[model samples]
Target: MPSSNDSRVERARIVASFGRQFYVRTLDAPGPDRVAVTRGKRTDFCVGDEVTIRLIGADQAVIERGLSRRSELIRSDRYNVKRLAANVDQAAIVIASDPRFSEELLLRMLLACATAEIPALILANKSDLATAWAAIAPRLQVYRDLGYPVIELAARDHPQETRAALSRYLTGHNTILLGESGMGKSTLVNTLVPGAALATREISAALCAGRHTTTFSKWFDLPSETAPSGAIVDSPGFQTFGLAHVSDSQRVHAMPEYTELIGGCRFHNCSHIQEPGCAIRAALESGAIDPIRYLLFSRLAGRD
Candidate 1:
Protein backbone atom coordinates (compact mmCIF):
# COMPACT_ATOMS: atom_id res chain seq x y z
CA MET A 1 0.00 0.00 0.00
CA PRO A 2 1.25 3.53 -0.78
CA SER A 3 1.23 6.42 1.69
CA SER A 4 -1.21 9.33 1.29
CA ASN A 5 1.62 11.76 0.44
CA ASP A 6 3.10 9.21 -1.99
CA SER A 7 -0.20 9.01 -3.81
CA ARG A 8 -0.54 12.79 -3.71
CA VAL A 9 2.69 13.27 -5.69
CA GLU A 10 1.90 10.58 -8.24
CA ARG A 11 1.37 12.94 -11.16
CA ALA A 12 3.27 11.88 -14.32
CA ARG A 13 6.56 13.52 -15.38
CA ILE A 14 8.31 13.74 -18.79
CA VAL A 15 12.10 13.45 -19.39
CA ALA A 16 13.55 16.74 -20.61
CA SER A 17 17.28 16.24 -21.08
CA PHE A 18 20.03 13.95 -19.74
CA GLY A 19 23.34 15.77 -19.64
CA ARG A 20 26.75 14.80 -18.30
CA GLN A 21 26.03 16.53 -14.99
CA PHE A 22 22.27 16.21 -14.50
CA TYR A 23 18.91 14.83 -15.66
CA VAL A 24 15.75 16.92 -16.11
CA ARG A 25 12.06 16.13 -16.56
CA THR A 26 8.78 18.05 -16.79
CA LEU A 27 6.31 17.68 -13.94
CA ASP A 28 3.09 19.34 -12.72
CA ALA A 29 3.80 18.99 -9.07
CA PRO A 30 2.25 21.50 -6.53
CA GLY A 31 -0.60 21.83 -9.01
CA PRO A 32 -0.77 23.25 -12.57
CA ASP A 33 1.61 26.17 -12.06
CA ARG A 34 3.70 23.98 -14.44
CA VAL A 35 6.87 25.00 -12.63
CA ALA A 36 7.83 21.77 -10.92
CA VAL A 37 11.45 20.95 -11.79
CA THR A 38 12.69 17.33 -11.55
CA ARG A 39 16.40 16.59 -11.72
CA GLY A 40 18.55 13.54 -11.00
CA LYS A 41 21.60 11.74 -12.51
CA ARG A 42 22.45 10.83 -16.09
CA THR A 43 22.74 7.07 -15.49
CA ASP A 44 19.66 7.26 -13.31
CA PHE A 45 17.61 8.85 -16.06
CA CYS A 46 16.89 8.95 -19.77
CA VAL A 47 14.83 11.41 -21.78
CA GLY A 48 11.07 10.69 -21.83
CA ASP A 49 10.79 9.03 -18.39
CA GLU A 50 7.29 9.29 -16.90
CA VAL A 51 8.33 9.39 -13.25
CA THR A 52 7.11 10.34 -9.77
CA ILE A 53 8.92 12.74 -7.46
CA ARG A 54 8.46 14.66 -4.20
CA LEU A 55 9.13 18.27 -3.23
CA ILE A 56 11.85 18.51 -0.61
CA GLY A 57 12.94 22.13 0.08
CA ALA A 58 13.64 24.05 -3.11
CA ASP A 59 13.85 21.19 -5.63
CA GLN A 60 11.86 18.09 -6.58
CA ALA A 61 13.29 14.62 -5.78
CA VAL A 62 12.46 11.28 -7.32
CA ILE A 63 10.68 9.07 -4.83
CA GLU A 64 8.71 5.91 -5.63
CA ARG A 65 8.98 5.12 -9.34
CA GLY A 66 6.04 4.31 -11.57
CA LEU A 67 5.83 1.30 -13.88
CA SER A 68 8.06 1.54 -16.92
CA ARG A 69 6.36 2.54 -20.14
CA ARG A 70 4.28 -0.08 -21.93
CA SER A 71 5.05 1.58 -25.28
CA GLU A 72 6.99 4.49 -26.81
CA LEU A 73 7.21 6.57 -30.00
CA ILE A 74 10.63 5.67 -31.41
CA ARG A 75 12.16 5.81 -34.87
CA SER A 76 15.59 5.42 -36.49
CA ASP A 77 17.03 8.61 -37.90
CA ARG A 78 20.50 8.26 -39.49
CA TYR A 79 21.07 5.02 -37.60
CA ASN A 80 20.44 6.77 -34.27
CA VAL A 81 17.58 5.64 -32.03
CA LYS A 82 15.61 8.86 -31.79
CA ARG A 83 12.92 8.85 -29.09
CA LEU A 84 10.01 11.05 -30.17
CA ALA A 85 7.91 11.16 -26.96
CA ALA A 86 7.20 9.04 -23.91
CA ASN A 87 3.94 8.06 -22.27
CA VAL A 88 1.93 9.44 -25.16
CA ASP A 89 -1.73 8.88 -24.23
CA GLN A 90 -2.57 10.38 -27.60
CA ALA A 91 -1.04 12.13 -30.55
CA ALA A 92 -2.53 15.27 -32.10
CA ILE A 93 -1.43 14.55 -35.67
CA VAL A 94 -1.21 17.98 -37.39
CA ILE A 95 -1.71 18.49 -41.13
CA ALA A 96 -1.72 21.90 -42.80
CA SER A 97 -4.38 23.11 -45.21
CA ASP A 98 -1.95 25.66 -46.67
CA PRO A 99 0.08 23.50 -49.04
CA ARG A 100 -2.83 21.09 -49.44
CA PHE A 101 -3.46 18.07 -47.24
CA SER A 102 -2.28 14.56 -48.05
CA GLU A 103 -4.62 12.06 -46.44
CA GLU A 104 -2.21 9.30 -47.51
CA LEU A 105 0.50 10.33 -45.05
CA LEU A 106 -2.08 11.31 -42.46
CA LEU A 107 -3.51 7.80 -42.50
CA ARG A 108 0.00 6.41 -42.34
CA MET A 109 0.61 8.29 -39.05
CA LEU A 110 -2.73 7.24 -37.54
CA LEU A 111 -1.83 3.65 -38.39
CA ALA A 112 1.51 4.13 -36.66
CA CYS A 113 -0.26 5.24 -33.48
CA ALA A 114 -2.57 2.22 -33.71
CA THR A 115 0.48 0.06 -34.26
CA ALA A 116 1.81 1.41 -30.97
CA GLU A 117 -1.64 1.04 -29.36
CA ILE A 118 -1.88 4.78 -28.68
CA PRO A 119 -5.01 6.86 -29.35
CA ALA A 120 -4.67 9.66 -31.92
CA LEU A 121 -6.62 12.83 -32.82
CA ILE A 122 -6.28 14.55 -36.17
CA LEU A 123 -5.90 18.38 -36.11
CA ALA A 124 -6.34 19.97 -39.53
CA ASN A 125 -4.52 23.32 -39.34
CA LYS A 126 -4.71 26.50 -41.49
CA SER A 127 -8.49 26.42 -41.56
CA ASP A 128 -8.49 30.17 -42.17
CA LEU A 129 -8.10 29.64 -45.90
CA ALA A 130 -11.34 29.30 -47.87
CA THR A 131 -9.98 26.80 -50.40
CA ALA A 132 -8.37 24.69 -47.69
CA TRP A 133 -11.59 24.41 -45.59
CA ALA A 134 -13.41 22.70 -48.47
CA ALA A 135 -10.65 20.13 -48.99
CA ILE A 136 -10.00 19.67 -45.27
CA ALA A 137 -13.70 19.17 -44.48
CA PRO A 138 -13.89 15.95 -46.49
CA ARG A 139 -10.54 14.73 -45.20
CA LEU A 140 -11.67 15.48 -41.66
CA GLN A 141 -14.93 13.66 -42.32
CA VAL A 142 -13.06 10.63 -43.61
CA TYR A 143 -11.06 10.29 -40.37
CA ARG A 144 -14.18 10.82 -38.26
CA ASP A 145 -15.82 7.96 -40.19
CA LEU A 146 -12.81 5.86 -39.17
CA GLY A 147 -13.71 6.73 -35.52
CA TYR A 148 -10.91 9.20 -34.78
CA PRO A 149 -11.68 12.70 -33.44
CA VAL A 150 -10.87 15.35 -36.01
CA ILE A 151 -10.61 19.14 -35.51
CA GLU A 152 -10.12 21.90 -38.06
CA LEU A 153 -8.12 24.72 -36.43
CA ALA A 154 -5.91 27.71 -37.12
CA ALA A 155 -3.40 28.12 -34.27
CA ARG A 156 -2.32 31.70 -34.97
CA ASP A 157 -5.86 32.98 -34.63
CA HIS A 158 -8.17 31.15 -32.23
CA PRO A 159 -5.77 29.71 -29.65
CA GLN A 160 -8.20 29.59 -26.74
CA GLU A 161 -10.97 27.72 -28.53
CA THR A 162 -8.52 25.15 -29.87
CA ARG A 163 -6.94 24.87 -26.43
CA ALA A 164 -10.23 23.99 -24.78
CA ALA A 165 -11.03 21.26 -27.31
CA LEU A 166 -7.57 19.65 -26.89
CA SER A 167 -7.08 20.20 -23.14
CA ARG A 168 -8.91 17.07 -22.04
CA TYR A 169 -6.42 14.69 -23.69
CA LEU A 170 -3.22 16.42 -22.50
CA THR A 171 -3.93 16.15 -18.78
CA GLY A 172 -1.38 13.77 -17.15
CA HIS A 173 -0.49 12.42 -20.60
CA ASN A 174 2.28 13.35 -23.02
CA THR A 175 1.13 14.42 -26.49
CA ILE A 176 3.38 14.61 -29.56
CA LEU A 177 2.83 17.09 -32.37
CA LEU A 178 3.23 14.96 -35.52
CA GLY A 179 3.15 17.09 -38.61
CA GLU A 180 5.10 18.21 -41.67
CA SER A 181 7.35 21.32 -42.00
CA GLY A 182 4.94 24.27 -42.11
CA MET A 183 1.96 23.22 -40.00
CA GLY A 184 3.02 25.43 -36.97
CA LYS A 185 3.69 22.70 -34.38
CA SER A 186 6.45 24.74 -32.70
CA THR A 187 4.38 27.89 -32.65
CA LEU A 188 1.50 26.07 -31.04
CA VAL A 189 3.78 24.58 -28.37
CA ASN A 190 5.30 28.00 -27.62
CA THR A 191 1.83 29.42 -27.13
CA LEU A 192 0.70 26.53 -24.91
CA VAL A 193 3.73 26.92 -22.65
CA PRO A 194 3.93 30.31 -20.91
CA GLY A 195 7.52 31.54 -21.35
CA ALA A 196 8.64 29.29 -24.19
CA ALA A 197 9.37 31.20 -27.36
CA LEU A 198 10.36 28.33 -29.61
CA ALA A 199 11.76 29.08 -33.03
CA THR A 200 9.45 29.44 -36.05
CA ARG A 201 9.81 29.57 -39.85
CA GLU A 202 7.74 30.05 -43.00
CA ILE A 203 7.05 27.68 -45.90
CA SER A 204 9.66 27.59 -48.62
CA ALA A 205 8.91 27.57 -52.34
CA ALA A 206 11.90 25.41 -53.22
CA LEU A 207 10.56 22.65 -51.02
CA CYS A 208 6.94 23.84 -51.04
CA ALA A 209 6.83 23.48 -47.21
CA GLY A 210 7.74 25.15 -43.93
CA ARG A 211 11.40 25.23 -43.03
CA HIS A 212 12.41 23.03 -40.12
CA THR A 213 12.37 25.26 -37.04
CA THR A 214 12.75 22.77 -34.20
CA THR A 215 16.10 20.98 -34.25
CA PHE A 216 15.45 18.18 -31.72
CA SER A 217 12.91 16.81 -29.27
CA LYS A 218 12.20 19.00 -26.21
CA TRP A 219 9.63 18.89 -23.39
CA PHE A 220 7.29 21.67 -22.20
CA ASP A 221 5.06 22.28 -19.15
CA LEU A 222 1.39 23.29 -19.26
CA PRO A 223 -0.58 25.71 -17.05
CA SER A 224 -3.62 24.28 -15.29
CA GLU A 225 -4.92 24.54 -11.71
CA THR A 226 -5.60 20.83 -11.45
CA ALA A 227 -3.14 18.23 -12.78
CA PRO A 228 -1.49 19.73 -15.84
CA SER A 229 -3.07 18.42 -19.05
CA GLY A 230 -2.18 21.08 -21.63
CA ALA A 231 1.47 20.00 -22.09
CA ILE A 232 2.93 19.36 -25.59
CA VAL A 233 6.28 18.47 -27.19
CA ASP A 234 7.66 19.80 -30.47
CA SER A 235 9.65 17.52 -32.81
CA PRO A 236 11.75 18.27 -35.85
CA GLY A 237 10.19 18.58 -39.27
CA PHE A 238 9.98 15.10 -40.73
CA GLN A 239 9.10 14.53 -44.37
CA THR A 240 8.59 10.83 -43.79
CA PHE A 241 7.61 9.33 -40.42
CA GLY A 242 8.74 5.86 -41.54
CA LEU A 243 7.14 2.75 -40.04
CA ALA A 244 9.74 0.12 -40.95
CA HIS A 245 10.14 -1.02 -37.32
CA VAL A 246 6.43 -1.78 -36.91
CA SER A 247 4.98 -5.21 -37.75
CA ASP A 248 2.53 -6.02 -40.56
CA SER A 249 -0.10 -6.90 -37.97
CA GLN A 250 0.25 -3.43 -36.46
CA ARG A 251 -0.36 -1.82 -39.84
CA VAL A 252 -3.59 -3.76 -40.28
CA HIS A 253 -4.71 -3.40 -36.67
CA ALA A 254 -4.16 0.38 -36.80
CA MET A 255 -7.11 0.76 -39.14
CA PRO A 256 -10.20 -0.03 -37.04
CA GLU A 257 -12.18 -1.06 -40.12
CA TYR A 258 -9.46 -3.43 -41.37
CA THR A 259 -9.94 -5.76 -38.39
CA GLU A 260 -12.96 -7.30 -40.15
CA LEU A 261 -11.16 -7.48 -43.48
CA ILE A 262 -7.62 -8.70 -42.57
CA GLY A 263 -8.69 -12.27 -41.96
CA GLY A 264 -10.75 -12.07 -45.11
CA CYS A 265 -7.65 -11.36 -47.23
CA ARG A 266 -6.89 -14.28 -49.52
CA PHE A 267 -4.09 -16.84 -49.22
CA HIS A 268 -3.70 -16.32 -45.44
CA ASN A 269 -0.47 -14.67 -46.59
CA CYS A 270 -2.29 -12.25 -48.83
CA SER A 271 -0.22 -9.12 -49.58
CA HIS A 272 -3.49 -7.19 -49.60
CA ILE A 273 -2.31 -5.90 -52.97
CA GLN A 274 -2.47 -7.61 -56.34
CA GLU A 275 -3.49 -10.81 -54.59
CA PRO A 276 -6.42 -11.89 -56.76
CA GLY A 277 -8.84 -12.52 -53.88
CA CYS A 278 -7.58 -9.85 -51.51
CA ALA A 279 -10.43 -8.30 -49.54
CA ILE A 280 -8.59 -4.99 -49.26
CA ARG A 281 -8.24 -4.75 -53.02
CA ALA A 282 -11.90 -5.50 -53.53
CA ALA A 283 -12.90 -2.92 -50.94
CA LEU A 284 -10.71 -0.30 -52.58
CA GLU A 285 -12.20 -1.06 -56.00
CA SER A 286 -15.74 -0.89 -54.63
CA GLY A 287 -15.04 2.45 -52.89
CA ALA A 288 -15.51 0.82 -49.53
CA ILE A 289 -12.01 1.77 -48.33
CA ASP A 290 -10.38 5.14 -48.89
CA PRO A 291 -8.01 4.51 -51.81
CA ILE A 292 -5.44 6.92 -50.35
CA ARG A 293 -5.34 5.07 -47.02
CA TYR A 294 -5.30 1.64 -48.66
CA LEU A 295 -2.40 2.72 -50.82
CA LEU A 296 -0.43 3.93 -47.79
CA PHE A 297 -1.41 0.81 -45.83
CA SER A 298 -0.14 -1.50 -48.56
CA ARG A 299 3.17 0.36 -48.61
CA LEU A 300 3.67 -0.03 -44.87
CA ALA A 301 2.46 -3.65 -44.94
CA GLY A 302 5.38 -4.27 -47.35
CA ARG A 303 3.00 -5.14 -50.19
CA ASP A 304 4.28 -2.18 -52.20
Candidate 2:
Protein backbone atom coordinates (compact mmCIF):
# COMPACT_ATOMS: atom_id res chain seq x y z
CA MET A 1 0.00 0.00 0.00
CA PRO A 2 1.18 3.50 -0.79
CA SER A 3 1.00 6.49 1.55
CA SER A 4 -2.31 8.31 1.44
CA ASN A 5 -0.55 11.63 0.98
CA ASP A 6 1.36 10.29 -2.03
CA SER A 7 -1.14 11.37 -4.65
CA ARG A 8 0.98 10.49 -7.64
CA VAL A 9 -0.79 9.00 -10.69
CA GLU A 10 0.70 5.56 -11.34
CA ARG A 11 0.24 2.82 -13.86
CA ALA A 12 -1.55 -0.42 -13.05
CA ARG A 13 -3.18 -3.36 -14.75
CA ILE A 14 -6.68 -4.52 -13.92
CA VAL A 15 -6.54 -8.11 -12.67
CA ALA A 16 -10.22 -8.57 -11.93
CA SER A 17 -13.47 -6.74 -12.56
CA PHE A 18 -16.87 -7.48 -11.04
CA GLY A 19 -19.39 -5.02 -12.35
CA ARG A 20 -18.14 -1.57 -11.29
CA GLN A 21 -15.66 -2.89 -8.71
CA PHE A 22 -12.12 -3.75 -9.84
CA TYR A 23 -8.89 -5.15 -8.44
CA VAL A 24 -5.76 -3.63 -9.93
CA ARG A 25 -2.09 -4.54 -9.55
CA THR A 26 0.40 -1.74 -9.62
CA LEU A 27 2.75 -1.81 -12.55
CA ASP A 28 4.93 1.01 -11.28
CA ALA A 29 5.79 -0.37 -7.87
CA PRO A 30 5.72 -3.43 -5.66
CA GLY A 31 2.58 -3.41 -3.53
CA PRO A 32 -0.56 -5.30 -2.82
CA ASP A 33 -3.32 -4.96 -5.38
CA ARG A 34 -5.74 -2.16 -4.57
CA VAL A 35 -9.51 -2.04 -4.87
CA ALA A 36 -10.42 0.46 -7.56
CA VAL A 37 -13.40 2.39 -8.79
CA THR A 38 -13.99 5.00 -11.46
CA ARG A 39 -15.00 8.52 -10.49
CA GLY A 40 -18.26 8.39 -12.45
CA LYS A 41 -20.53 5.77 -14.03
CA ARG A 42 -17.86 4.79 -16.53
CA THR A 43 -17.96 1.01 -16.38
CA ASP A 44 -16.25 0.25 -19.66
CA PHE A 45 -13.10 -1.14 -18.04
CA CYS A 46 -12.43 -4.86 -18.37
CA VAL A 47 -9.83 -7.28 -17.08
CA GLY A 48 -6.33 -6.96 -18.60
CA ASP A 49 -6.74 -3.22 -19.11
CA GLU A 50 -3.70 -1.02 -18.42
CA VAL A 51 -4.91 2.02 -16.55
CA THR A 52 -3.64 4.97 -14.57
CA ILE A 53 -4.68 5.25 -10.96
CA ARG A 54 -4.23 7.50 -7.91
CA LEU A 55 -4.23 6.02 -4.46
CA ILE A 56 -6.87 7.50 -2.13
CA GLY A 57 -6.19 5.17 0.79
CA ALA A 58 -3.72 2.48 1.82
CA ASP A 59 -5.67 -0.25 0.08
CA GLN A 60 -7.87 1.53 -2.43
CA ALA A 61 -7.49 3.74 -5.48
CA VAL A 62 -9.38 5.68 -8.11
CA ILE A 63 -8.97 4.82 -11.78
CA GLU A 64 -7.95 7.95 -13.56
CA ARG A 65 -8.21 6.72 -17.14
CA GLY A 66 -7.28 3.86 -19.38
CA LEU A 67 -4.27 3.62 -21.62
CA SER A 68 -4.36 2.83 -25.33
CA ARG A 69 -5.44 -0.76 -25.88
CA ARG A 70 -3.43 -3.04 -28.14
CA SER A 71 -6.48 -5.17 -28.83
CA GLU A 72 -10.02 -5.52 -27.49
CA LEU A 73 -12.56 -8.37 -27.85
CA ILE A 74 -16.18 -7.26 -27.87
CA ARG A 75 -19.59 -8.86 -28.41
CA SER A 76 -22.81 -7.01 -29.12
CA ASP A 77 -26.50 -7.60 -29.58
CA ARG A 78 -29.13 -5.10 -30.73
CA TYR A 79 -29.34 -3.74 -27.19
CA ASN A 80 -25.81 -3.74 -25.81
CA VAL A 81 -22.13 -4.04 -26.54
CA LYS A 82 -20.08 -6.01 -24.00
CA ARG A 83 -16.31 -5.63 -23.85
CA LEU A 84 -14.65 -8.91 -22.95
CA ALA A 85 -10.98 -8.09 -22.49
CA ALA A 86 -8.31 -5.68 -23.60
CA ASN A 87 -4.61 -6.03 -24.49
CA VAL A 88 -4.87 -9.70 -25.24
CA ASP A 89 -2.27 -11.17 -27.58
CA GLN A 90 -4.47 -14.03 -28.73
CA ALA A 91 -7.66 -15.93 -27.94
CA ALA A 92 -8.28 -19.65 -27.53
CA ILE A 93 -11.80 -20.80 -28.36
CA VAL A 94 -12.43 -23.94 -26.34
CA ILE A 95 -14.98 -26.42 -27.65
CA ALA A 96 -15.88 -29.92 -26.56
CA SER A 97 -16.71 -33.06 -28.52
CA ASP A 98 -19.56 -33.99 -26.19
CA PRO A 99 -22.69 -31.95 -25.40
CA ARG A 100 -22.89 -30.94 -29.06
CA PHE A 101 -21.26 -27.55 -29.33
CA SER A 102 -23.07 -24.90 -31.35
CA GLU A 103 -21.31 -24.14 -34.62
CA GLU A 104 -23.19 -20.83 -34.86
CA LEU A 105 -21.76 -19.55 -31.58
CA LEU A 106 -18.29 -20.79 -32.48
CA LEU A 107 -18.40 -18.99 -35.84
CA ARG A 108 -19.56 -15.78 -34.17
CA MET A 109 -16.64 -15.90 -31.70
CA LEU A 110 -14.16 -16.49 -34.51
CA LEU A 111 -15.62 -13.57 -36.45
CA ALA A 112 -15.45 -11.35 -33.36
CA CYS A 113 -11.78 -12.20 -32.95
CA ALA A 114 -11.17 -11.64 -36.65
CA THR A 115 -12.92 -8.28 -36.54
CA ALA A 116 -10.74 -7.33 -33.58
CA GLU A 117 -7.66 -8.38 -35.58
CA ILE A 118 -6.57 -10.77 -32.84
CA PRO A 119 -5.06 -14.16 -33.59
CA ALA A 120 -7.22 -17.07 -32.43
CA LEU A 121 -6.86 -20.85 -32.12
CA ILE A 122 -9.34 -23.59 -31.37
CA LEU A 123 -8.92 -25.95 -28.44
CA ALA A 124 -10.92 -29.14 -29.06
CA ASN A 125 -11.21 -30.33 -25.52
CA LYS A 126 -12.52 -33.74 -24.33
CA SER A 127 -10.50 -35.77 -26.80
CA ASP A 128 -10.43 -38.60 -24.30
CA LEU A 129 -14.11 -39.21 -24.98
CA ALA A 130 -13.47 -41.52 -27.89
CA THR A 131 -17.02 -41.74 -29.20
CA ALA A 132 -17.65 -38.04 -29.09
CA TRP A 133 -14.16 -37.23 -30.35
CA ALA A 134 -14.73 -39.47 -33.34
CA ALA A 135 -17.91 -37.62 -34.17
CA ILE A 136 -16.40 -34.08 -34.00
CA ALA A 137 -13.02 -34.85 -35.58
CA PRO A 138 -14.10 -34.18 -39.14
CA ARG A 139 -15.80 -30.93 -38.29
CA LEU A 140 -12.63 -29.81 -36.48
CA GLN A 141 -10.73 -30.65 -39.65
CA VAL A 142 -12.73 -28.05 -41.55
CA TYR A 143 -11.34 -25.30 -39.28
CA ARG A 144 -7.83 -26.67 -39.65
CA ASP A 145 -8.21 -26.50 -43.42
CA LEU A 146 -9.11 -22.85 -43.05
CA GLY A 147 -5.70 -22.27 -41.36
CA TYR A 148 -6.81 -22.03 -37.71
CA PRO A 149 -4.72 -24.28 -35.48
CA VAL A 150 -6.95 -26.75 -33.69
CA ILE A 151 -5.37 -28.62 -30.77
CA GLU A 152 -7.16 -31.60 -29.28
CA LEU A 153 -6.71 -32.36 -25.60
CA ALA A 154 -8.62 -33.58 -22.57
CA ALA A 155 -8.14 -30.94 -19.92
CA ARG A 156 -9.43 -32.95 -16.96
CA ASP A 157 -8.63 -36.51 -18.00
CA HIS A 158 -5.16 -35.85 -19.39
CA PRO A 159 -3.77 -32.80 -17.66
CA GLN A 160 -0.16 -33.41 -18.69
CA GLU A 161 -0.99 -33.79 -22.34
CA THR A 162 -3.27 -30.77 -22.17
CA ARG A 163 -0.53 -28.59 -20.66
CA ALA A 164 2.04 -29.82 -23.14
CA ALA A 165 -0.22 -29.18 -26.13
CA LEU A 166 -1.14 -25.66 -25.01
CA SER A 167 2.35 -24.59 -23.83
CA ARG A 168 3.55 -23.46 -27.24
CA TYR A 169 0.55 -21.20 -27.76
CA LEU A 170 0.26 -19.94 -24.18
CA THR A 171 3.91 -19.11 -23.69
CA GLY A 172 4.87 -15.45 -23.95
CA HIS A 173 1.35 -14.33 -24.75
CA ASN A 174 -1.61 -12.88 -22.89
CA THR A 175 -4.37 -15.24 -23.94
CA ILE A 176 -8.08 -15.10 -23.24
CA LEU A 177 -10.11 -18.30 -22.92
CA LEU A 178 -13.46 -18.13 -24.74
CA GLY A 179 -15.96 -20.93 -24.52
CA GLU A 180 -19.57 -21.80 -23.97
CA SER A 181 -20.57 -23.40 -20.68
CA GLY A 182 -19.47 -26.98 -19.94
CA MET A 183 -16.54 -26.92 -22.37
CA GLY A 184 -13.98 -27.64 -19.59
CA LYS A 185 -12.54 -24.12 -19.72
CA SER A 186 -12.43 -23.94 -15.93
CA THR A 187 -10.60 -27.25 -15.78
CA LEU A 188 -8.19 -26.03 -18.42
CA VAL A 189 -7.53 -22.86 -16.47
CA ASN A 190 -6.86 -24.79 -13.25
CA THR A 191 -4.52 -27.13 -15.12
CA LEU A 192 -2.59 -24.24 -16.62
CA VAL A 193 -2.60 -22.00 -13.54
CA PRO A 194 -2.69 -23.99 -10.36
CA GLY A 195 -3.72 -20.97 -8.32
CA ALA A 196 -6.75 -20.15 -10.46
CA ALA A 197 -9.21 -21.88 -8.12
CA LEU A 198 -7.85 -20.10 -5.10
CA ALA A 199 -7.94 -16.83 -6.95
CA THR A 200 -11.53 -17.46 -7.89
CA ARG A 201 -12.41 -18.17 -4.29
CA GLU A 202 -10.71 -14.98 -3.21
CA ILE A 203 -12.59 -13.01 -5.82
CA SER A 204 -15.84 -14.62 -4.70
CA ALA A 205 -15.14 -13.63 -1.10
CA ALA A 206 -14.26 -10.09 -2.11
CA LEU A 207 -17.38 -9.70 -4.20
CA CYS A 208 -19.55 -11.47 -1.57
CA ALA A 209 -20.93 -13.78 -4.21
CA GLY A 210 -21.30 -17.51 -4.38
CA ARG A 211 -18.37 -19.59 -5.58
CA HIS A 212 -20.24 -20.59 -8.76
CA THR A 213 -21.44 -17.11 -9.57
CA THR A 214 -19.00 -16.22 -12.33
CA THR A 215 -20.20 -12.73 -13.11
CA PHE A 216 -16.75 -11.27 -13.70
CA SER A 217 -13.53 -11.90 -15.60
CA LYS A 218 -10.32 -12.68 -13.69
CA TRP A 219 -6.67 -12.66 -14.76
CA PHE A 220 -4.09 -15.21 -13.63
CA ASP A 221 -0.35 -15.12 -14.05
CA LEU A 222 1.02 -18.34 -15.49
CA PRO A 223 3.67 -20.17 -13.50
CA SER A 224 7.11 -19.25 -14.79
CA GLU A 225 8.15 -22.87 -15.37
CA THR A 226 5.03 -23.48 -17.46
CA ALA A 227 4.70 -20.26 -19.49
CA PRO A 228 7.17 -17.52 -18.75
CA SER A 229 6.09 -13.97 -19.52
CA GLY A 230 2.52 -15.09 -20.03
CA ALA A 231 -0.88 -14.60 -18.45
CA ILE A 232 -4.39 -15.88 -19.09
CA VAL A 233 -7.81 -14.34 -18.50
CA ASP A 234 -10.72 -16.56 -17.54
CA SER A 235 -14.03 -15.02 -18.59
CA PRO A 236 -17.55 -15.99 -17.68
CA GLY A 237 -18.89 -18.66 -19.98
CA PHE A 238 -21.92 -17.52 -21.97
CA GLN A 239 -24.48 -19.22 -24.17
CA THR A 240 -24.68 -16.37 -26.65
CA PHE A 241 -22.01 -14.30 -28.43
CA GLY A 242 -23.37 -11.55 -30.65
CA LEU A 243 -21.72 -9.53 -33.41
CA ALA A 244 -24.02 -6.60 -33.98
CA HIS A 245 -20.92 -4.41 -33.62
CA VAL A 246 -19.46 -5.92 -36.78
CA SER A 247 -20.53 -4.42 -40.08
CA ASP A 248 -21.64 -6.46 -43.12
CA SER A 249 -18.46 -5.66 -45.03
CA GLN A 250 -16.30 -6.41 -42.03
CA ARG A 251 -17.99 -9.77 -41.60
CA VAL A 252 -17.44 -10.75 -45.24
CA HIS A 253 -13.79 -9.75 -45.19
CA ALA A 254 -13.20 -11.52 -41.87
CA MET A 255 -13.86 -14.90 -43.48
CA PRO A 256 -10.51 -16.14 -44.76
CA GLU A 257 -11.95 -18.09 -47.73
CA TYR A 258 -14.14 -15.19 -48.83
CA THR A 259 -11.49 -12.48 -48.85
CA GLU A 260 -10.01 -13.41 -52.23
CA LEU A 261 -13.46 -13.58 -53.83
CA ILE A 262 -14.83 -10.40 -52.28
CA GLY A 263 -14.52 -8.13 -55.33
CA GLY A 264 -15.54 -10.73 -57.90
CA CYS A 265 -19.28 -10.10 -57.50
CA ARG A 266 -21.13 -8.49 -60.41
CA PHE A 267 -22.45 -5.65 -58.30
CA HIS A 268 -19.82 -3.66 -56.39
CA ASN A 269 -22.13 -3.59 -53.38
CA CYS A 270 -23.16 -7.24 -53.66
CA SER A 271 -24.65 -8.57 -50.42
CA HIS A 272 -23.37 -12.06 -51.28
CA ILE A 273 -26.75 -13.43 -50.19
CA GLN A 274 -28.87 -13.62 -53.38
CA GLU A 275 -26.82 -11.81 -56.01
CA PRO A 276 -26.74 -14.05 -59.11
CA GLY A 277 -23.09 -13.25 -59.97
CA CYS A 278 -21.79 -13.40 -56.40
CA ALA A 279 -18.42 -15.12 -56.34
CA ILE A 280 -19.02 -16.43 -52.83
CA ARG A 281 -22.12 -18.29 -54.02
CA ALA A 282 -20.17 -19.65 -56.97
CA ALA A 283 -17.41 -20.86 -54.65
CA LEU A 284 -19.95 -22.46 -52.35
CA GLU A 285 -21.49 -24.33 -55.25
CA SER A 286 -18.08 -25.47 -56.53
CA GLY A 287 -17.13 -26.78 -53.09
CA ALA A 288 -14.38 -24.21 -52.77
CA ILE A 289 -16.03 -22.93 -49.59
CA ASP A 290 -17.53 -24.99 -46.79
CA PRO A 291 -21.34 -25.04 -47.04
CA ILE A 292 -21.70 -24.91 -43.25
CA ARG A 293 -19.59 -21.80 -43.07
CA TYR A 294 -21.47 -20.25 -45.98
CA LEU A 295 -24.75 -20.93 -44.23
CA LEU A 296 -23.31 -19.45 -41.05
CA PHE A 297 -22.38 -16.33 -43.00
CA SER A 298 -25.91 -16.00 -44.30
CA ARG A 299 -27.31 -16.38 -40.80
CA LEU A 300 -24.90 -13.87 -39.32
CA ALA A 301 -25.59 -11.42 -42.13
CA GLY A 302 -29.34 -11.74 -41.36
CA ARG A 303 -30.01 -13.23 -44.79
CA ASP A 304 -31.31 -16.51 -43.40
Cα lDDT tens digits for candidate 1, 37-117? 434432333345666655433334444454487567765433454556666667888888888756666766776787677
| RMSD in Å for all candidates | 7.4, 2.0
TM-score of 2: 0.94
Winner by TM-score? 2
Candidate 2 C-alpha lDDT tens digits along 102-201: 8998998999999999999999998889998899999999999999999988899788888888888899999999988888777888999987888788
Best candidate, lDDT-wise? 2
Candidate 1 at 303: error in angstroms? 8.6
Give the residue spans of candidate 1 off by over 4 A: 1-23, 26-47, 50-67, 77-80, 198-212, 225-230, 301-304
Per the 3 Å backbone cut-off, how many clashing residue pairs does candidate 2 have? 0
TM-score of each candidate structure, all chains considered together: 0.74, 0.94
Clashing pairs in model 1, backbone N/Cα/C closer than 3 A: 170-229, 171-229
Locate the minimum summed-lDDT window of 10 residues in model 1: 198-207
CA lDDT of every candidate: 0.64, 0.88
TM-score for candidate 1, residues paired by index = 0.74
